[model samples]
Target: MPQWSDYTNGQRIKILRGREITQPQLAERCGLSVVTIQKAEQDKVLSLTTLLRIAGALGVDTSVILGQQAPRRAMSMDDRAMLRELSRAVHDSWVGLLPRTVAAPSADELRAAVDACWARYWEGHYAEAGAIVAPLLEAATAHRHEQPHDRQATAWGLISDAHRLAAYVANLMGARDLAYAAIGHAQEAAESAADNMRHALVTSGRAWVYLRDSRLKAALDLAEKSAVDIEPRFSRATPGELVAYGSHVNFAAVVAARLEKKERAKEFLSQSHAAGARLGEEIAAHGTRWGPVSATTQAVGVNVGLGRIGKALALADDIKDVSALSPAAQNRYSMDLALAQAHARQWDASLDTLEETLTKAPEWSRHQVLPGVIVEKVGRASTARLRRVSKLLGVSNPVTGGFDTATEKSAL
Candidate 1:
């Protein structure tokens, strides 16, 4: 009987890939060169970034790919049944397919429904959010059509938001094509609504889709353009406008950081911080979250991505209100904190943080990739502690297969 830990990383990749995809096909799927794919399977030079992208393209838990899964922890919004429904809803609404005759909710009711789903999404309840969003998309489309001429635009705006939510959940699920379609419809609906701020927000949303797709240059362009388009006059800016502007700049910074443009990333981050200062506390508008806490929290990740581990840790200390963030945000911060500790060679501290976060948010952690990365890089941790953490995350170490821990830098 072969345990997952018994197989080298390369062998595991080969087994998982099976006969379904050739090396070049897998290379194309991962957006890497064929030689890179070959190297990975040969266990020649597995960088954290390489493994992360590979796991993402394969739509599997990073831990599962890293090691044995005892029983795989199926997470990361990979609810096939739910996603299938969500997909059908998105495409159906886009092409005007519906239940022959549909009754549209009142504008207030429709908006409230969309808000609730967004709430669920931010709470890290991705599957729950998708379940609700499927029906909401269908109803919102109906509402957009059934509303009176004067109220039509309002209905359209709601439709845009629903699609945005769909895109977001789909993106995290690694369903890139579906995410692109959903956001495309989101932007179109926003245009029909004729709301400039809403449209700009949708553009940022699309930039995020691009970011996840490894379209760094394109993502940066869209994010920067949107930020400039809505560059608010600070003193007179409304909270919504500030949040929108902050989100765009923050994303631009994130993309810039990934692109290794240090100064550009810092510049956009500073703008985001200013916008957050003006906006004060965290707030959600147009289904997106931004404000002082979000801006600061995002800075931690930006610094981490830049390999400024000490700066990242210092920034982590400054965040006093992480409990106030949405579940997903809090989990993200925990990963950053853990990664920082791991990079500092504080292996036990990193594992402790990961253990605490995973125990608290198994569902969200299951779909994420960073946990595996953290464990992999904590090379000095005790075997017992490491195995416990590995079992918890359902990941196995690839160090024996020549994975490069020193190369654990880049987009998460």
Candidate 2:
């Protein structure tokens, strides 16, 4: 296990300083006494409230200040409820510690913390994002161990999200084995919790792993099962919850298309689009964090699958700020870009985008598998095509392979 002590005290100070605010200024912003803020900066221990306030002032979630690491053992139902209670406790403790401040957080506050982390992960900032939820996951897991099985489901669901983000970061760094290990840990957490939404996310993540390893059949099977399980559950869920599941299905469809299973791919695509439609209606009725999955974005991959390269390329302009989507969504964008380039026989452009995706992605394990497989396949395919084209054109040195401006532009 890596320790914060692994970095020199100087480096640690630098990292903190990089947050763009002085201790006294941060204290003022967070309404903390200058003495308390100075204490924290000088390595003196303060109340949890003070620490949390300082953390917030620094623009980091409280979890970042806590020395929490990866997910641990699974939980039972009572344990799950305890974890939820623990989350409440941590937040309350933070709130009560507010420098001369007080107010209990609403449900939105709790959800917002998680959502912020999600956005960070989307932007390819994994380490920072993972830190954002470390405390919540740690507290929940610790509480679950002490509690009974009554609320294990809810607790695990929450913890699984953190693990999911962790896995995504691992994947981004090209650590394939690490990525799978993280996913396994998260899967155990979700299964123990037994929440369908969490289960769907875990199952879909696993399916992507299989797809990354080129185990398309296994990927399709896992996706199919997840979609089936989630359909009936959607009616009982909020619009945002339903949209999350739809995103998972859309992810599975992309894998199916990669395997060249035309009918199966089309089938999954239909299900994915249909789910998106329903989710969109729900989001419109009750405003969601992000709008519905753009029909045009989904169609891009579908068009590429059908070999309508020009059509897919034409729609590429519809996708705005690829970095703004979730990690999975960003990966999909990269995959779609590669697929579009591949269909158009622009081998160089495809490889370039693949390289860029690999570069900008997080270091989570969950995000690793599919992207690796895609890059490997596209690289090999592109290499073969280049060789063939070179031989046919009688070019003496037809630049064997390299990333160029075309790829970087697409990645941006």
User: Relative to the true structure, how large is the alpha-carbon lDDT of every model?
Assistant: 0.80, 0.54
Error of 1 at 400 (Å): 8.9
Counting clashing residue pairs in each candidate, in order, gives: 2, 28
Candidate 1 has what TM-score?
0.78
Highest TM-score against the true fold, candidate:
1
State the local distance difference test value for candidate 2: 0.54
Could you tell me how far off, in angstroms, the CA of residue 72 lies in candidate 1 after the best superposition? 11
Candidate number of the best lDDT: 1
Query: What residue runs in model 2 are displaced by over 4 Å at the alpha carbon?
Result: 1-112, 133-136, 146-149, 232-237, 281-293, 314-335, 338-342, 345-412
1-412 per-residue lDDT for model 1 (tens digits): 3677788887777766766678888888888999998998999978998898777666565676688552133432237557768899999988889886667888888888988998998888888999999989988988777767877888888889999899998887666788999999999999989988878888888888888777889888988888888899998999988888897888888888888889999999999999999988888886778888988888988888777889999998888777668899899888988988888888778889999998999878766667777777774554457777776775455332122232333324
Tens-place lDDT per residue, model 2, 87-191, is: 343334222222222333333453566677776765555556645554544544554544557855655665576566556544544334655765776787788
Model 2: what TM-score?
A: 0.54
